[model samples]
Target: MVFGFLTSRRRAGLRAQPVPPEWRQIAERNLAIFRRLSPADQEELLQHVQVFVAEKHFEGCGGLELTDEIRITIAAQACLLLLHRETDYYPRLRSILVYPSGYTAHGEHHVEGGIWEEAAEDRLGHTGQRLRALVLAWDSAKHGALDPTDGENLVLHEFAHQLDFEDASTNGTPVLESHAEYLAWGRVMNEEFEALRSAEDAGEPTLIDQYGTENPAEFFAVVTEAFFERPHALRRRHPALYERLASFYRQDPMRFVPIEQERERL
Candidate 1:
């Protein structure tokens, strides 16, 4: 209890402090989505970023050098998920490991008949409940920050895994506010997940990534990327899924687009 109070106080102080000029400049220069946010939302995101940067430990791997630019850029994108929602700054996530670029991860993959094969796969970002850390490739992260409409974002994809783990599991569902919300989330997410799988099996083009078919957990993460980055397309193609995400996130990313551009896209 005492520790919790002290931690809260420290975070309060961090949020109260004015955002540094350099940090603002970094967001403006690197994150196109930041400029699109309303002034109030922008301030809220910065406050969350302040607390997130202060709390999380960041390390550069693969000979990458850590800098404030890298930290703030990543934090801004992650905290975008927390805007207009109650958050604990991803309490289970303690460290962020950044690589200069995509890195190879060696792991075992289940082949068939209770057989597992060792393989190396290139990964841009990764996180797990047990690992208590998120990893990102700086190059991919920067591109995600720069291109807000790409329908792909490494930071959002990985931090979403952290959200999924909040309930002590890596299922598609996160901690919803009420029983009704949970039921709706489960129904909608399951439907969308299956639809994506069927589309993949048919070799049909999909708005959501084919990677989402990997599992429920990956489905949630991939959809989250599309939720923020390709809001118009997702809303048009899968309105129920988009509504569920908007309700959970408490933000309509469609509002972030300028009125003229929104009309053009529509």
Candidate 2:
């Protein structure tokens, strides 16, 4: 219904139809994330991922080919969030603009001498700029995706921004159903946000990313990264925070991740 948003018809059209075994093979090969999902969840997600990839247009930003692997990897991660919600949850988002690797944004800044440097600003795509819902393949976007501990998974991080924007402000609160829930959400999230900010300000390392201390919105996005990538740790460190996120997401990834881990061990 909103401009720049895709219609349900368009989304229906993009639904992953019967794909050849090759595409599934490609998706499994590049998407460690796909393997993390349960079988039923995987099939459901695959359907959504198909439609998601079909509906959004992809352009090669850095001379890289928009291969099936790239599309699947991006779709797989994005669809991971939707595993617990409906496609309409992302109805506000239409296109997914991805980069081969990390990109930079240039801006102006002020100096102490009251002089402004025209090129004083240097920011990684993940670290700066909040526009143009970006899904970057960090490996290709910047230095490649091999480093799991770079404190940056651009795809996961920025898509979390898209989720944050659903509440209309990137201030960490997303669109919840009712006013009472909204009140509870504000109280819980603000408390958690304060804890993260205080921990970082005190120069103590916290399980959550320190960058989350940057602001409420950053707190939402960064904590979301912790949610998907490290659900158990989030639950262990902040049980209330984990519970609220599980409620909002409608999926107890803390439960799902462990089930997934157990399956793998077996």
Top-lDDT structure, candidate number: 1
- What lDDT would candidate 1 get against the real structure? 0.90
Residue-by-residue lDDT tens digits, candidate 1, 1-266: 12478888888899999999899899989998899898999899999999999889999999999999999999999999999987888989999999999999999987999999999989998898999899999999999999787778999999988988888988988889999999999999999999999999999988898999999999999999988888887888899999999999999988885433432232
- Each prediction's whole-model lDDT (CA): 0.90, 0.64
- Number of colliding residue pairs in model 2: 12
- Once superposed on the true structure, which residue ranges of model 2 sit more than 4 Å away at CA? 1-6, 89-95, 109-117, 120-152, 256-266
List the candidates' TM-scores in order: 0.94, 0.80
lDDT of 2 by residue, 1-266 (tens): 24335566666555546755666775566655566567887788787877777666666665667776677766666677777675454544655555555465455666668787756332334422344445454354322122223334556676667777765676778777678878888888899888877887788878788888778878888777777656767787788888878877787665545533422110
Clashing pairs in 1: none
